[model samples]
Target: MTPVIELTEIERTFDADPPVRALKNVRLRVEKGEYLSIVGPSGSGKSTLLTTLGLLDRPDKGSYRLDGIETTELDDARRTALRGNRIGFVFQAFHLLAHRSAVDNVGLAELYQKGERRSRTQRAEAALQRVGLGHRTLFRPDRLSGGERQRVAIARALLGEPSLLLCDEPTGNLDKANTNAVLDLFDELRAQGVTLVVITHDEEVSMRADRRVRIDDGVLSDGSTSFQGSVLR
Candidate 1:
């Protein structure tokens, strides 16, 4: 099977008085339809890795291939197009437009992709229904619960029909109940053959993934331990 994401010796450094190396010789592979979690504490380069994977940031040195296409050398325009078409992002913060209805928020995702306005609206509604938020289509972000708001964000991400879903702290702001709901939704998505890569500090979230990788001090490790043993301080 072809890998959805492949990174080889990825390195990223932030220029400072003393340069900060955010990623050091990172190597990772995520196969199609795989659910992989990257666990790490704050400031551990996990976010940087996600940005690189999502094509929002370029590594200082490495080879990155997305769906069999080498992305490391692509021009900014090409990269942006690939990222927009192939990647979907879910952040901890809902990042929803407070004034827009759930359906509208989702429809915004399709605005850039060429399509009839009516078709985009229809697609948005379908995505919301998929996430169990069909009834909340008219609700604004402020009126929705934290989980509901996150679902809207997820719906927006899915509106693009992306090949890879990259979530950063997807459950960071939710209560246990909502977190479980989101995790369950992720399981369902996996069952439906969606590729998922989640970056989080939560142990419970990590355990739900089919594979887990630990990152600390800008280094990566194969996290093969039990949930109890995988906690990062």
Candidate 2:
């Protein structure tokens, strides 16, 4: 079967005084509905890889295939549309609107959609309910706990029912209890068939994935363990 995401000979660079190569000929492929973690220390290019996959940043050289469609040459408008329809992203920061209610924060993401789909409130509410935040829909970010705010972020990411969910340090702000809760929710999402690519340095978090890939000094170690048919056991 064709992979849902494929990165071939990826190279990304930043123009420092001496050019900084963030990624160097990185190759990766994520299968459909697979939960995988990219583990790396600081400056290891994990975030760069994630952003490139999400199309938020373009690689200097490489071929990125999303759902079998190559996406290197698409214009900004087309890229944004593809991201909205096919990829969901959660960042380290909650990135929620401070003044908007939890439901409204999520509803706002639907505004960019092209067609008349579900009502904003309905879509937001359903997403919140899925993330175990149904009771906190009316609460604003300031009114919610740290974990609750992160759940709201997750809800917003889920609103699009994306083929690939990209999370960067998703549990960075939460306590241990909340981290476990969020990880459990991720397991549930995997069971229900959501392709997850999480960039994290946390050992506990990385262990939860079906496969663990370690990136050290911008190179993948031999630790790319794949669970071919294991249903996340």
Candidate 3:
């Protein structure tokens, strides 16, 4: 089967007196329907890697192929278009518009797409219902619980039916109960054949994924160990 994401010898560096290497010779492959977690501490290259994978940043040198298209050589507009069409993002903060209803928030994701307004609304409603938030479609973010807000964000991400769902610290702000609720939703999404790549520091979240990789000091490794020892810390 073709991989949904492929990174070959990826390298990204920030210019400084000595230059900071955010990622070094990173190679990763994520197949369709795979649920993978990237675990690391703060300041590790995990965030940089995530940004690169999400097409928010470009590597200095490497090949990044998303769903078989060579993304590295694509221009900014093309990259943005591909990212919007093929990738979905869920963040820790549940970045919903304060004044918009849950259904409106999800519908907003399709604002740039060429579609009838009624069709977009129906799609948003369906996405919300898929995440078990059908009853809360009219609720605003401030009126919902933390878990519900996150579900709204997830529904918004799913509005485009993205091929890959990229979540960054998705459960970071939630309590155990809410975190479990979100994790259960992820399980359901995976069962429905959505590929998920989660970047997080939480061990429980990592453990829930089908595969776990670690990043430290710009180096990526399989499992949890590194030359300096445990990568979790």
Candidate 4:
């Protein structure tokens, strides 16, 4: 089976005075239904990689294939469309509209997608239910707790049934209890065959993945030798 996301010799450079390289020969492959995490500190190119994977930005060089489609050369419109249809994103910030209810927020995501809007309400409700937020469907962002709000965001991301769910610091804003709640939801989603690639700097977050990869100085390395600062795999 083809990987959901594939990057080969991916290089990204910024046009600063010194022309800094944000990514260097980064190669990664995420299979269907896999849960993978990429961990790195600030200035370690995690954000750059997230943008590239989400199709929000193009790499300066190399190939990025999304579900077998070559994305690097695709036009902006095509890339946007592809990203909308194939990828779902969750961020550190919930990014929920303040005035919209959980269901409304989730339903709105489907409006931009390429399918019939029929049963949108039902689908959105189901998504909320999937994230264990069925009771909060009518609740607005401000009324919900941090973890509840994040779960609502996850419901929105899952509205498209996306081939890949790309999350960045998904649990960063929550307290320990909420963080564990959100991560438990991620674990449940993984068990149900949702493909996820989470980018985080937290060791606890990275360790939850089936496999973890570390990124530093634009280089990517396997988890076997790096978790807990020892070779434990």
Candidate 3 per-residue C-alpha lDDT over 1-233 given as tens digits, one digit per residue, 9 for 90 to 100: 77998888889999998999999888888999999898999998988999999999999998999999999999999999999999999999998999999999999998755457768889999999999999999999999999999999999888888889999999999999999999999999999999999999998899898888888888878754552222221
Better of 1 and 3 by lDDT: 3
Query: Which lDDT value does model 3 have at 47?
Result: 88
Where does candidate 1 stray beyond 4 Å?
224-233
What digit string (tens of lDDT, one per residue) describes model 2 on residues 55-126?
999988878999988899899888999998888888889999999899999887787654345577898999
Listed in order, each prediction's TM-score against the native is: 0.93, 0.91, 0.94, 0.95
Q: What is model 2's C-alpha RMSD?
A: 3.9
lDDT tens digits, residue span 148-218, model 1:
99998998898888999999999999999999999999999999889999999998899999888888867
Alpha-carbon local distance difference test for all models: 0.88, 0.85, 0.89, 0.90
Error of 3 at 20 (Å): 0.7
Ranked candidates (TM-score, high to low) = 4, 3, 1, 2
Instruction: Tell me the alpha-carbon RMSD of every candidate.
Output: 4.0, 3.9, 3.2, 3.3
Better of 2 and 3 by TM-score: 3
- Among the numbered candidates, top lDDT falls to 4
Q: List candidate 4 segments past 4 Å from native.
A: 223-233
